[model samples]
Target: MYQFPKGFLWGAATSAPQSEGAALKDGKSPTTWDKWFEMEPELFYDQVGPENTSNTYELYKEDVANMKAMNLNSFRTSIAWSRLLPDGKNLNPKAVAFYRDYFQELVDNGVEPIINLFHFDMPWWLMEKGGWEARESVDHFAYYASVAFEQFGDIVKKWATFNEPLVHIECGYYGDAHWPKVHDFKRAIQVGYHTLLAHAKAVAAFRESKYNDGQISIILNLSPVYPRSQEPADLEAAKWADHIYIRSFLDCAVKGDFADEFVALLKEADLAPVTEAGDREIFLNNTVDFVGCNYYQPMRVQAPEVAKRPISDPHDLFAPYDWPEKRINPHRGWEIYPRGIYDIAMRLKESYDNIPWYISENGMGVSEEERFENLDGIIEDDYRIEFIEDHLAELHRAIEAGSPCFGYHLWTFADCWSWLNAYKNRYGYYRVDIKDGFKRTPKQSSFWMADVIAKNGFSREQI
Candidate 1:
């Protein structure tokens, strides 16, 4: 049996924008998601919008009860900036009260709440001010972080500054998948830089707050970059991709600066974001106490095909190379590379001084899960169990190989709504029936997960 270390945090995660359904209620301002849905309802799957999420805003107590029942010792979720500060400045009394009671409930149930400050649900007012592209957004974010720490920092010991911040840069700025949809690489770089600066400022705030010893992190959705071949160009392309996507934020948050090669690349392309003289000091002085790694897929790339490259575009440095033998989750169209977890841990150990980290988010999303419901009215999600087990096996290998991994958290706790995708892909041990009052019901995997938590290890024979 492969045993997890003592006090391993067995947990699950969900974001406020994805799980909480009250979009524009109780003095809450509209987020970019709510406004986007209002502008283009057709863009979302089944025309579902942020207002129709898991209704956790109203059903949070039940959610906590479910977590306790599932043997979850910890839960990671984000506080909606719009909810906490409706106008992005003043605190909302009702919102503060709601979060306090909710977090207290989690603690009362023995589930430590790992709260994050941002999860891409930018308040529309902030987006109107150019969002992360504006330097002022960094100050506003720092203020918001300070307020959060002052309010609930005592109850929520573990805090994250941002969740998958690269997604905001890539999807919102470089692609049209998210809010403020624009296809400008220069804008993406600025947004990414500003976001990192905000994270550093938040870390600084956490240090000054009374809960200085409490853990603070930035949850990065990291992907291992693979080359198409062992050729010099392919290897160089892969390394460049890694620097841009993974190391850019990883190094800044963990090691306190961007790689020299990455900075050179930015300067050569004339794509560097504007920065103040003291920004470097802010980053260096406010490095995070830990890291939260969200691994789902790997990036396979080769050198760009054309001889000439566009100076404005970052993608000009590399070209995507789809692996023919890659196993994929057909439901979500993501590569199922379990070994990437081990690879990521080893890289962190060797390259980044082995910072204490956790599998902040890792789970399989399946479509039409109700089709697998058995006669007992429970979804027989043995496939989800198998997916988690495979990943956990690789995590065990990483732990044994001297990786400083302390915990593992699945992507979600309940079948919550995804932005744009809505409820298309369900990733929860407890199936939340959206049609039937958002009822929560445990699937087969929940029982299996409970047993794993109880034992702290599992053998293949159990399966």
Candidate 2:
């Protein structure tokens, strides 16, 4: 049996925008997701918008109960910026009350709450002010972070400044997957610079505030990149891909500054972000207390087919290489490589001074899970159980090798609404019925998770 260390956290994670339904309720303002749905409803799956979600806003008490039932010792969820400060400047009384009650409920139920400040759900007002593009947005975000710490400092001990800030930089600016979709490389780099600066400012705020005792982190989706061949060109492509995708944010967060090589590349390509004085000092001083690594899959890459001397986009330096022997989750259109978890852990150990961290998010999202339901209205999601076991086995190997991994959290607790994808893919221990009053039902994996958490370990025979 592969056993976890004592007091290791076991739980799930979900963002406020993805789970909390009452979008405009309780004096809350509209977010980018809400505005996007209004402008382009067809972009979401089944035409479902942000308003039609799991209704956690009203049913969080029950949600906490479900989490406790599954033996989850911890839970990670974000606080919607728009909800707390509808105008992005002033606090809303109702929103503050609601969050206090919700977070307190998690603690009351013996579930440690790891609260994230931002998860790409910028208020519509912020977007109107150019969102992350405008340098002033960094100051606004720092004020917001101070407000969160001062308000919830007593209830929550662990905090995250941002979740997957790269997706906001890549999908929202460089691609068209998220809100304010545009295809501008210059704007993307500036947005990334502002985002990281905002993170540092928030960390500085936390350190200066009365809640300086609390731990702060940033959750990054770090995927280990693999080369398609042993050729030097392919190897170089993989290194560049890692620099662009993972190290850009990882190094800044952990080391408090960008790598010299990355800076030189950006300057050579004329893609460097405009920065002001004192920014370097802020980054150099304010580093995270720990890190949250969210690993889902590995990235396979090769040298770009048509390499440009001065790269215009990240794709110009590296190209995706499809592997012949790869298992894929056809439902989500993602490659499933459980070993990536170990690779990520070891990379953090060897490359980042063995910083303390945890698996903040990891899970399988399968579509049409109803097809696996048995007669008793229980979904026989044996595939989900096997997925967790396979990933945990690899995680155990890393832990045995002295990786400072303290916990593992699945992608979500209940199958909450996913942006763009909507409810098309179900990734929860308890099945959420969106059709019938958003009822919650435990799948087979819920029981399996309970058993694993109870023992704090499992073997292949348990499967």
Candidate 3:
């Protein structure tokens, strides 16, 4: 039996825009995502936008009931900044009332609500003012965070300042997967620095607030970097990849400073972000109480091929290589390396002092949903069940080796709108039928997960 500790948090996570439908209702303003969808509908799958998602805004109570039915002891959801503070300054009373009622409903259903301040839904007005690239935007976010803490701190014992900050930096700034898609390395670095600053400022605000007893953290999607070969060049390539992708934010959040070598390399390349006076102290003084890590896959790096012409794109510096022999999830196009979770846990334990981390997001997203339907009219997702089991077995191994992991939250509770991909890929225990009046149907994996949560673990026979 792979038994987890007693009271280990068993829950699922969902973001506001991904699940909540009411985009412009109750004094809500448009986020950058809302504006992006309007500007380029074709960028989304089948032109599906976030205007009408799973209707969680109006059906949160029913969702909480579903959570309770699944035996979930905790649920992680983000507060829509556009909903709470439409202008990014004033609080919307209607939105405030809605969140109070919604969070209370989760608590009423015996599910601990884990609140996150930002989940890639920046206010359009704030984006117009340059978003995270501008230092002033950091102050704006800190003010918004302070309001959230003052308002919801009593009910919510766990708060995350930002969910996947590097995702916004990489996708929105470096890649084109998210809103405000800009492809500039310098801008990406500036935005990343400002984001880390905003997190630190929020941590400082939370510490000074009257409701400072609760734990606060930042959720990072930490993927370990691995060399594709034992060659020195491949190992060096992997080191660079880890420095740029993992240590860039992890060091700043945990150690309260950027790695000197990393900073020096960026400076040498004229890509270092501009730092203001006293910003160093802000980060140094307010390290997170804990860290929320979301592991999906390991990164395979190899030495770059020499080219006659100069390489201009900064993304090519790390030289990310795909191993043809690596195990892969055909549907989602992600590498399937369950051992990466244990590697990440060990890294946290040895490097970050094992400061009470948890798996905030881990799950399988698959295509071809129709093929999974069974004779009982449910999604018999045995693949997803096996995926979770394998990952949990690795996680159990890490915990047994003295990793301070207290919880595990799957990527989502239900199939909802994903950014860019929209509803093309579904990653949920409960499947939501978008065409059928947004119906929620529990998949086979949901029942399996319910049993796992009830037993506090799983045995080989159960699998």
Candidate 4:
């Protein structure tokens, strides 16, 4: 057994919208997700939208019990921002009661709940008011953060300010996948800067709050960006990719500054982040205590002779140019290189002083329907099992070589919802009968995880 350090945190991760259902039952206003799901349900795969998800909102007590059944020591779940404030200010008693009770229930179950403030679900009213692209949205976000921490901080100790700020930029704004879809590189830059400003402000507020037993952090989707080859152009492309993907937020949060080269790129491209005079100083000054890492796969980058402009959907009225480069990942049609995890850790250790980090979100998403069958409902998810084990092995090696990672929280505790993917990409240890009122049935990997948590290590390489 490769013994992990004492008091290592081993649990599963979930976002509120992804796991918690009752998306709009309890006095909750329509977030952008609710609006989108209502307006164009067909936009999602299989026509499965984000209306009523895993029923976690209604079944949280039972869900907590299920976590205990799975031998979880700590659980990661984000708080729905709209749920808390409804309209980011109007107090919703029902939402408060639901979350209060849910968090308390988890605590009673001996499972420490790590609460994140925002998880990709933006309040629709904010969208009408310009969403994340406007300066006011940042203030609104900071206000939401304060409200959440003030209310839940007593019960929830670990608070994630935002779940993957860059993702909300790339997928939501720049890519075609997410809400308020736009492909404006200039807006993307401004939006990223504003989001970081909000994060730093929230972290500062959290430190000032009465909650003393906990810490506040931001979870970023960090990938190990690799050059496609030994060519210098490819290496430069990788560096550019890294700056946009990780360093932009990382340096802002940790060093209280943005990279000069990064700023230069924005200026040279005329896509520099729009910010208030002191925003940079504010973000660089206030730092987080930990990092919530959402590791999916590595990125292979190569310079494009001519990168295309950002692609826009019907929703966005304006657009700008995108990076002049290319990226590829074959496994799963996305990247599947596990060494990215090691590279991320090594970079963090070497550059950022190895600030305390946890793998807040990491797991493999597979089509779960055809995989699980009549073997007493056991999903021989050897593929998923291998994915996690491989990442953990790399993490272990990094730790041995001096990476200050404290814990690992898989992408999910159970299959819930992916903003646009619906139920197509299942990342869960337990399979929920999507039709049977979302009844959760533990997969074969569930027991495997429990044993790993119970013993803190496996007896051998392959269980």
lDDT of 4 by residue, 1-463 (tens): 6567778888888888887877777777788788887888889878776777888887787778888998888988888887888777788888888889998998898888888888888888888988878889878887887788778889999888888888888877678777878877778777787788888888877877787579878898887777667777666667777777788888887888988987776676677767678786777668988887888866656766654433122112111223335222322455466677888888889999988898898887777455556558667777778777877888888888888888889878878888778888777888877798898887777888888888887655656
How does each model score on TM-score?
A: 0.99, 0.99, 0.97, 0.93
lDDT of each: 0.92, 0.93, 0.89, 0.78
> Model 3 residue 56 lDDT?
92
Error of 2 at 406 (Å): 0.7
Instruction: Score candidate 2 by TM-score against the native.
Output: 0.99
Give candidate 4 misplaced runs (Cα > 4 Å). Answer: 307-331
Best to worst by lDDT, what's the order?
Answer: 2, 1, 3, 4
- Give candidate 3 misplaced runs (Cα > 4 Å): 307-313
Worst 10 residues of 3 by lDDT: 307-316
lDDT of 1: 0.92
Q: How many residue pairs clash in each candidate?
A: 0, 0, 0, 1
User: In model 3, what is the error at residue 91, expressed in angstroms?
Assistant: 0.9
Give the alpha carbon lDDT tens digit for every residue of 1-463 in model 2: 9899999999999999989999989888999999999999988888999995899998999999999999999999999999898997889999899899999999999999999999989999989999999999999999999999999989989999999999988999978889898999989999999999999999999999998787999999999999999999999999999998999999999999888988998899999999999999999999998999898889999999888858889988899999989999888888999999889988999999999999999999999999999999999999999999999999999999999899999988899998889998999998999889999999999999999999999979987
Alpha-carbon shift of residue 166 in model 2 (angstroms): 0.8
Task: Candidate 1: list runs displaced more than 4 Å.
Answer: 307-310
Please name the candidate that would achieve the greatest lDDT relative to the true structure: 2
Candidate 3 TM-score to native: 0.97
lDDT of 2: 0.93
Query: In order, what is each prediction's RMSD in angstroms?
Result: 1.0, 0.8, 1.5, 4.1
Candidate 1, residue 20: lDDT: 86
